[model samples]
Target: MSPKASKPLVPAKTDPAAIRNFCIIAHIDHGKSTLADRMLQLTGVVQPRDMKAQYLDRMDIERERGITIKSQAVRMPWEYAGETFAFHMIDTPGHVDFSYEVSRSLAACEGALLLVDAAQGIEAQTLANLYLAMEHELAIIPVLNKIDLPAAMPEKYAEELAHLIGCEPEDVLRVSGKTGEGVDALLDRIVEEIPAPVGQPDAPARAMIFDSVYDTYRGVVTFVRVVDGQLGHREKIQMMSTGVTHELLEIGVSSPEPEATKGLSVGEVGYLITGVKDVRQSKVGDTVTSANKPAEAIIGGYEDPKPMVFSGLFPIDGSDFPVLREALEKLQLNDAALNFEPETSTALGFGFRVGFLGLLHLEITRERLEQEYNLDLISTAPNVVYQVTAEDGEVLTVTNPSEFPEGKILEIREPVVDATIIVPAEYIGAVMELCQSRRGQLEGMDYLSEERVEIRYKMPLAEIVFDFFDQLKSRTKGYASLNWQAEGEQAADLVKVDILLQGDKVDAFSAITHRDHAYAYGVKMASKLKDLIPRQQFEVPIQAAIGSRIIARENIRAIRKDVLSKCYGGDISRKRKLLEKQKEGKKRMKMVGTVEVPQEAFIAALSSDEGNAKEKTKK
Candidate 1:
């Protein structure tokens, strides 16, 4: 749910050229949000006492985690050179996982404040987003922040950033977002450097929906950027892509609070209420235009996002399926990128095959489900979409291992990605070794500066989904930044390895791994499962198999009863009789014993044995 507030609207100065639309871009903890707070404070959009840390981040999860999961747009009035300038600012996330959020935020703006930490220099996310901004043809104003810190060396970092982005180091602006220094000059530079919004105001209304959230009282509150014409209150509007129409209820902008306005024109960023109940009707990237006088062409860049990772989400109680479905429906209303459909596992019963942009996105969705709805859930191991080609040239995309076809005539093509890592020169060797161990092919290496290097590699999406980031952090001492993008598909020698509990294949515990390394992984996984699964009354055999070939096996020892505990010293006949009786009882129990695998066991068995087992063995 959106943690938003409603307030009165102070009409913004609507002249398109007098308005500047921009967003703050930086690395995580590189002062993106802090700089936004300073800007809001300086412009008097938020009072000093009313201002708090991460004032733009309204979500409790966002503030507690010190990250921006959602992009926030606000309008502020600031006077410079005897004229009041209206600034439409977007505060974007700085993490690689939320790169899509940053992209959407940038899509709404004509310029971006390219913030770089004065002490940390530049990072992976910083470069990734800088490239994104360049792709959007947005003007970037380089700003060095956190100069108040003792470790800050603005001149040195400025040169580094200028060298990478190909700008003059002297042109870089310096600021202390924490201390509110150099903020005013930065605002002045935005006007002089960033271009004004360019669009035909007399044309049909064309506002791009950049972000949205479902409100408990208002339904879908779509955040939009007005590129052409204007949205009038009580006018019938149409979604350019969906062709669905809705009556406009109200229009407004965010001033860190939702404010109602009569109408919004070109160069304005605001939210709209259409009285629409379905969130899917108003999606990000969809264009809102006048129904009566629709535009000739739909706004560009409205394609749906592809899910990078997929997993099974099952309710612990089978009766809770309806409740789980309702919860997912509500969550998906706000998160358009989230995809799910009904799926069933032999062991997990009925569930949903949920797809997410990345691992972190999946993690956040699950936490919200459990926390917001108070439901118990189990998630299977994450996997990526695989292309399975038959001899007849029939290609099918598969995300679940249980759904992987047998005797599918031809090769399996797995998604591959072009990965980039930025690290200190000293740790280059270690980082390269770690990447190589994950089956990454070294593409190239560049010396960004005397002390930093940028390494590029081609890696399988499966490897990236499973512990690659954690392993990289371990090797680089958390000093390296990694970024990746899908690079189509490649043929691979892959196999589905299934884990069997007491001779029964547990579909939820299966995974796809490289054929050559499957046996070793199978062995590690079998042993790990043995440790995780509780001891049953009878021995439970844990096995990993590829097709009918069993690659590895382990057994969970049974809980043996000391029947002789009550026996007196050396009564051989009595001891023998008791042992025979116990043996008979064990045989009977073994024939009827059904090992119940715990939920945690399924999670542990399907995972790569990193910390729980000898991860070095895989190397």
Candidate 2:
């Protein structure tokens, strides 16, 4: 019989001991998705004729970029040693910005497969994710992937991986995700090595909503992991955090593809649909329980992800403000970390100041907005949140540089991060020099093996927000990997630089920068504006200023009419009279004329902040 038409794989009361919940954790481009495809095939969840690569990556962007953005869960039935075992597998994103997704997935699993590329070995994000898994106390099974590669160094990296995880080299499993070599053995190991989930199946129905996305036809689809009891289709449930109740309309599992199931029991993962249209009703990290006999306590361990970078997202057309708001609301339903609020700029008019986890997140969000919503947008230069303390002792949180206080300021604190960099031993000097140039303070260093070294530094978040990763890659020849986390705020010599056209400040062009580099920033902005802004009827001076003092200035020559051409061979007095008259007219025009900045100029100048990161990522 076809899998879909067969009886529910999850029986009404299956043995919890036969279920193993786990997720794959690795660095970017390390074959996480490739391995997932192999497992799905081996389990027969997806028919061979219908199989495709990166099967779990459903979004077009994910397939194009060759990166996993969202965490995808699947349930597969494996027949091993004369018994059928249900495997709940979650494939997570490896990028540092999406580490929050990995954390949420980790909370719902009992084990993690730490996959390391045999050819490339361990990276910065590898250690960062390892720490996260360790924090959750999950059983980590080290696996070396890409054993089929010509440059595969399984023995070398196996020892390195084992050393980091405090395991013997022999314990690290080896497999080629490309050719399916040793995949069957790997699946058997998963069943033998990983422990089954433990929970009270007879208790009140409780599940944790790890993720949720809005469906246009069916409303909100929530992905949950049953923690203590069984959740049946058509059962009434209540969200513990919000106290909102809804009846479950459909319940199913994604066996590489969505298939209807009778219900999900403890130690199982599946999707729940309540047919609710409001996106706010279903939230990630919220606990779901039976409305009639709800669990006594809510499942509360994970914290909401905080946005580390802030940028203003303004539609090119002013009338699209409401549409932009709606797009952001729907996007937020899919991305819990995204945050935005209505903001107005004198130059850009109506827009929203959006917060993102990092530069990658910002870029992805912008692309989705333009592609899916069909709205033209102009994004301001990204910045970090700053804490400003005034002379009156009141602290103000400033997400946009335009919101910087005008009065006397006591101190400005910028967010700092604890950065971890892993590179070859030969490039240690280049890495250290680059870090020092960005105002990084050395914490410590350690040699993971004979050739690999790990360096730690505490650096300001602003320094690395733009093109720091690109620079590091160039300096180290694309061998260095980086991961960082916010480590509170540090008081610094920071000042807000304002770009003024004529005498008016352009709030969209404002930025908060270190006092030491403020002059250079001012000069760059002044010169850039000089080239972008067209010549007006009267000379328009572009100046970059700090409070009352101008640090840099440039002038756009006026477009003057030639009155002297008509006075050829005339007396010097006649030419002088005509010149004076023209000069007087120019002065009057300067006094009343406003400098009109073209939308193209604003778009170019604002997006210029992206620099090398944009180019490097594209390649």
Candidate 3:
């Protein structure tokens, strides 16, 4: 007879329950997702072999980028102390650009698992996110991860957490997400230490929509944390902002695979299906109340995030303009932080002025728009917020160069950013040199460990706004990590360098440069403009100037004769059509006096290579 199969042990649901609503918060690549996987395995939520890396990062883009773009929620039934509990785990985005999304994820939870790298300790972004969690009054369970690494220093990290968050150092949990050591104990502590949801569930349905994104089939999926009462699937709900009422079609707790639950109670996070045709209708932070029985309105729902970086996104091909616009609209449905307005350029054709949270956010957005949507885009140089005072004493915002007042006889303020860089101690000297070259002032330095150093810098936002992270990575051989925060505007000696093609000013090719590097930057920009701007019918003089002073000049010699002077037999119509298309293309180009310039001239003129080349040639 076959041996009787042993009965699988089932966790008891009575007595001390195992349910814990919590989220993991950490800086990018500090092991938040890795630790989450380990937690699932330790709790028997997923087998060790069945587990995949960043399982919650289900989006194709997220998997390719190895970053969590959207917050994810998972339910794991675990047993501790002879009682079963449902652990609702939320994984949040680590980058500061998605801080708003992180806040929304935190609002849905009663507690947080603050994951700090044992060797790296607290970073600037980590501290920033931790503060956001504190504001929500979420109970924090500090965990020091990466403890298995040879350089791990759990005790020091514990002390840092104690100092930074006012938590006890001895009480900090040290666990190796890689080796899965001490993970089981951390799970037990989460059930024992974290407090349960306490809001009144019998009250009228009042849910807070923290973040939302558009789906093709699902329409709008709004992530809400029920503050009071209960929300069930197919229940009628009204949006406080727009007063639009709809029935919840489907309800889930997270993205990708939402748990098809009946209802979500107080302090529970879940998604609502309102059949919202547009994502803007279910705006993030909008209050969702019952149409029949409403509760006290949620005031000051969410402040509109101010975009710091601005740029123009145009299509490379003029005919693809409509496609680009549609792509942007689709992207906006998912990304609430992205702001855009329809714009047209003589050189770039149709485009839009896009606002982003910061430089990284801008790059990521552009990359996604192109890669995900399969659209070719021509992006103008990124710009910072500029405060300009008019001649009549009226202040105006100037994000684009064309909007700048021609005769601003007053002060101009440029955005400043607080930057932090962490690097191996051996590369400290080189890193400091590069930062100083970019006009960065050393604020202070903290010795993170015997081999690593964290340096702080107060830098002009313009200096490090472009390619600074790339430069830092290259100099440190990919060992350095950088994080920055906008430090408001500061009065600076700034001048706009205009690059002229064929002795005529191309407004789009202008950039604001520091007075110190104006000449060098101008020369480099002029050279690049020459290379990118196709040689026109007439010779184009690429000149860079600061106000009335000419700083640099390059000449893009015009094509002497592009037309075939000798015509062949029986090909006149085809050749004529080709010539007509070329003429139409030339009409799209910006004609600056005698020469015709392409759209790429504006972009190339803003590059550092042109400036560097000018410096070399001058020397």
Candidate 4:
């Protein structure tokens, strides 16, 4: 350990050949974290008794959800084949939503371990991430994981991966993340197959901030991989992107735990504490170098993230607005993909229109807010950006319904996506039927193997924004996996349908739907609302209308009152007067009766009872 905190933990003269920078890439639930834990145990960095599952997954929410929301980097030393080597392992996220960030950060790695489940064969994300690895020209070593299981089919999956990656099936190494079977071979392969990082230690320090998180006391701590030279403590550094300068307070590496390193040198991955408060200054993919002697060339950064799914997020209590804002800021420090802006809703009042990479990303953000920040939130239905060409020829990109102009639009174009689904051949017809029912156009279909097929469809983004994935899973018995990307834009007959209670539009319950499905959707929405809303003294009309053209209506019948009691000693004229008086009183009460809509109903309106569209089911 260096007392000065400005020196490298290892010698500055350490050889680049001794360091291997690699990341583990796998599809979700394919044992990525489990494998990393095994590596830690094998390296003697953590004892077996002290070891826990998913050791690198540090967040409580991440541990509970069994998902990796972000990437993590760690350094450990190992000796193999009579030579000492240092492994800088990056545990990348397995979700499709975070794949782009992982890809961009892959530039920092010399190679990647492509983990595939033997029983599941090839999946949509497996292929998707494999292509991304190839795009970056990463040395990908296919590892057939879960080989110890009774249902494991390592031989078959090896062939599937080999066919896709153009490698010999025998070259795919088999390992069981659970029982540690053949893990030694996998480790040896990492050192042998993955090349040493190439960098010039004599040159000026140049590092890429692959990930960053905010600490209350430390400000912003950025995780970086040194491309060249060395970074020292108390050194003034400049962010190439923001052109901002700051002092490096501390430098260290996560050896499964944060350990103080004097600084990071060439071919090393570690954390840099720059005392940066605003996360915007320490952006992911930004170049960091010494301010006194900066690098000549700046590292090319990743493209700005584009959020495809849009929804409004509001605190359950309006008084918690400021609290929610602070929570968002803190959360944003860990997630650069989350985009939000303040907006007002007539029905929900003050709130924000938040944008997410996908539906899963939307759900994760909401969960973090509720569980971590302890703030109750209400999120409106998720929607996609629409290009509206007005009657007067003006064009607008509408994300929120409140932003819609009052006039009739000549054309409204919604976003479309290229979706690839991989499932067993038996379920092909079911998936095809579901896609077609959602107005999907078949793009291509090909046989990956005798019993497996890949089905590609071009479908409107709005169609799958809510229940499509759920339906696909149910239809295929959870065997189907999907990957989607935005395919430019397409024209559609779209209308914004508003839910009216007592003839007043509720903006929070409004949604844009295709005109062809408006009748059925409207009828279902009106019916669902009628059931959710409590009955009042007067009959309340729950109607779904398209710009005042009522398409579906459901009425909540008023409770009948037997107000006339037996007239013991009164004549027929007295009974008539009593009935007339009771009728007048009923009319007065009807005028004053108010329908109080509960918070649950507003949140429930975001998705249908069939499936959760706005939120992902907790897996």
Candidate 5:
């Protein structure tokens, strides 16, 4: 027999007159998902026994990663001001990489529950999202979460919210998502404060697709906010992107509980059943209009964000190329943030130069590709956008090494980033030192609390492209949180450093370097490349050069005696088999005439270990 399910604490249904459509927005780990889970339980949408930490993050990878990667919707009926109403709650992603996804979720709602950590207070991302909500004209309801913690400072946070977001201090609701303290009051405020979405239900079916994900069994499951009309199951719908029409196989409103009702109406947030198998077909930010009477096109439905960082992602093993490509394709079907193309590497092998929103985004994508898809990949170092002035007086955006200007350029500009870091007050000195070490200029600092400070800095996007966070975490004992935004371009004396392994330039290992650190960086790169490239039949020269000047060079001595010293007599087939295997392996190596350059030589050239080790030695 199956285990008995627990009964919901609150009644299943309440008066529908008090309904409110709102979403919870916060920086990562600020308790948005947890608060949603608590609200669902309090509203009887989910039972107490069935409660999970982040129920909205149903994806296995999300649960393991402890981050909400996608936006999730749920409905709950509650009572407020002597009236019953349905509350459609959307839980949005906090990371800036998913800013587009968050915007889509906000478009579906009329109000937002901005969750701020009581102890940590407002962060850069929190402020950014608040501005986004204001741009959308959504009613912002500030909530101070984690009030039950010993370090909680609800009053201070309330004041900050009022000052930062222009919301009244008294209007900020203090609630503990952990202990459920003051949670019901928040629910009541939601119904009282948030306005009901106004729209006619009889108009032609017009829905906005805020987000979409691919399902193996369900095809494309699109989350939409019905804007103008009522949609019914089996109704024909036209997607704005491809103009391909598809019928709604199913229509349903999501609840914290699985047994919720189906078929949602106007002003309600729910899912549509597009029989289309590809998620890309139902692009997020597209419009779904009635096939019979489509209205004047949905304006600004979805605008693709330009990728700011680019890098090559290749399989560690040549044989895994096919599997890696399949994995990326599958990931793209679910994540619109990831973009890539087929690319070739002289040292690393076949791969794709994938573009991402930011450094964090790149890391998350790489981690997901490896963990979810079970593929091993070699990633090129991340690169920021560079403005190159050509000899013809035309400015070009160069992201890849191949696109860089080949002639003497007039000037080179790199993208600068405004970075904000929050850390414990005791670690302020260390954090400052760390930032300065990365060529960062201190902007300003603010004391968030007696023991915590938020430091602002202007840094080159190229500085933090690698494991800067790891260094910060180590220095601050994992207490520092970083947030940054592109701050346009800055004139820099920068040069493209081309790395050559076995005399041939490895484009994937190339980088834009500051003139001050060119020599050091070149030596470090050459050393690393020497380690990554395997020994071949001939000695390989690893060189790093800026234009015509060679700054650093390392050599991998040829295998002085790779030839077999002795051969067993009469075992001609065994000897032949060994020789053929060696020959095939040698053929895989890129040959510059008689010289065979192994793949490892290319990878070592890009490793950060060489630079890190040199820095340690200098210290």
Candidate 6:
């Protein structure tokens, strides 16, 4: 017999004790989504025919990439010990860039399924997420997934997971997300192990908005976890953060699908649709309360995510700026970590300097904007924030290379991160060598097992922001996993490399690199611009320089129109005079000539294609 009933499990006024709120946390491609599908099937929330791989991953980009970018919440019904329980399961993204989403999900849940791939054992990100879960004091249910794989060492990994989580080896549950073996028992274990949420049911209506998304047809759809009291449909709700009130047009729970609910009470998770079209009004981590009877205190919200990578995102067509703004506003509602501000580039035109958590975050955001909003965009090279201390005893924050202070005769501090890498013991030498090459300082190393080793390093953010991860994976033969967090900033010998075209500085091509690599960076950039920028009517000198010192230079020779071609039998003096006239005209043109860098050139030069190609060649 099935473990779950065919009908809806929870009543309208169900007791809070019967609700179990939890999330599944794992490393990238560790079967979190597949396990989620199995649970939904076991609970019969999604019928067999309607089921698809990565059901929780709704966007095409997510489905294609086979990675969860957003945390999806679903309510499943399970019969545990003759009691029908409503399980609010949040399947979170496992990538390091999306850790902010996991953190937000943890705040709403009481437990997390710490899933380890039995074939791969524990990874660096797995440990990082485990620490986050522990910080939240959530019950940790150790789960070993992919047990059916040929290389799966369930017993070995079970012990590894047990050692990490301070649990017994046998206590680690084994399950195959693909075949659905042992999933039913895992569900029952969730009921037994995870605690029910605790909230005051008698207080004024209060719900914590963990996430919100902008819907074209429905306006701003906010996902909230009811912390106390009850919120019903058509009630006027006020945002505790903004004090803005709006009518709740719809209230419902996602049983893998949006099913209308009359109201949401304490400990229940549901979505709310307010008539307000503005995405800013419904903020994530904001408290929602009844406008008439407001709650006394707001829930402690999540700390704002600090953006680690900054890049310029400009529309290929200038007219799409407003559309890009609207799209960014909507995307921000979905991804709260994304930050942007208006900035103008002389070469790239008007655009926004967007901040992302990492390279993947920047890529995903750009792709989403292009795919979802139908806007063509040109993105500049990704960079990390730097602190420039001037000789005047003032510190300035620089996000873009163009903003690097001029005449700065003081220290430059660059952001650094404490990076943790887990790899096979044999690859330790290669990993260490790669780290050292990127100016990484070894902090510590430990043996996770007889064959697996964990290495910690403190590295500058700018060094790894480009291709460090790729290099690590290549050096380790894809057996290594990495996780990192900001470790403040350290003073570094850094210089800003400015790209000048015909003696004019191009802000879009400027970059801040370590002093040691400034020459190489300048040379490469100047060479690339020489290939990208077309030959002008006058000779254009592409120079990469630091202050008055020219480190590297490339020249785009002018398109010469032969004056002698028209003169068949001219006198030598006449030819000389004509050549002199031509030379003088060229000099005059060079003086007044303004190099117009084509849009394609800007796109090609700024794109990550060259960097990726270099990484590929290294691999």
Compared with the true structure, all predictions reach lDDT values of 0.86, 0.91, 0.76, 0.84, 0.78, 0.90
Q: TM-scores, in order shown?
A: 0.92, 0.96, 0.83, 0.93, 0.83, 0.93
Error of 1 at 433 (Å): 1.0
| Candidate 4 lDDT trough over 10 residues, lowest sum | 610-619
Best by lDDT: 2
* Per-residue lDDT of candidate 3, residues 1-619 (tens digit): 1112353222212121234778899989888888888777776766667779887776777888888878877777667878777777888999877777787777777789888998777776787777778888888888899999999988877987886677789989999888889988888888888887666667888888877877787688888777777777678888888888999877656412455566777666667777777999988878888888877767343666778789888876778878878888998898888899988765667889999887768878888888987876767788888888778998878888777777754878888878888788999998999999998889999976566688999998777767787789999898887777778778877778887655567766778777898888787777666666677655557789877778888887645445545556667887797678766655455363456554444444443356743443333
Measured over all alpha carbons after superposition, the RMSD of each candidate to the real structure, in angstroms, is: 3.9, 2.7, 8.4, 3.3, 7.7, 4.0
* Candidate 1 vs candidate 6, lDDT winner: 6
lDDT of 5 by residue, 1-619 (tens): 1112362222222222345889989999899988987888898977877877888898777898899888888878787667678889989999877787788788888999999999878876787788789888998888999998899988988987887777688888999998889999998888778888876666776788887878787687888877777666677889866789988776666775333233556687777777688888888888888888875657363567668789888887789889888898888888887889888866667889898988767878888888887876667788888999988899998878767888878888888888889887899999999899888999999986576687999999888877787899899888888877779888989888888766677677788888897888889777765665567665678889988778899987766444455774767787777778776665455364344444454444444556643443333
Candidate 1 total steric clashes: 0
* lDDT, candidate 1, 243-322, per-residue tens: 99999887887777777777898899988898788898898899999999998776785456788999899987889899
TM-score of 6: 0.93
lDDT of 4 by residue, 305-366 (tens): 78999999998799989988888888888788887899888667788889898888988898
Instruction: Report the number of the highest-TM-score candidate.
Output: 2
* Total clashing pairs for each candidate: 0, 0, 5, 2, 15, 0
Model 6 C-alpha lDDT per residue in residues 1-619, reported as the tens digit of each score: 0123344433455589999999999999999999999999999999999999999999899999999998999999999889999999999999999998999899999999999999999999999999999999999999999999999999999999999989899999999999999999999999999998898888998899888877777777789999999998789999998998898877888888877667899899988988777767888889999999999899994776899999999998999999999899888877778989999998878899999999999989988999999998888899999989999979999999888888955899999999999999999999999999889999999999999999999999999988899889889999999999999999999999999998999999899998999999899899988987878888999999999999999989999889888788858888899989988999999999899887777776776677643443333
Query: Clash number for model 2?
Result: 0
Off by over 4 Å in 5: 1-18, 166-170, 257-263, 297-302, 393-396, 423-458, 474-477, 530-540, 556-619
Off by over 4 Å in 2: 1-10, 609-619
Instruction: Flag clash pairs in model 3.
Output: 18-85, 19-85, 502-541, 524-610, 524-611
Give residue 124's error in model 4 in angstroms. 1.0
Off by over 4 Å in 4: 1-8, 566-594, 610-619
TM-score between candidate 2 and the true structure? 0.96
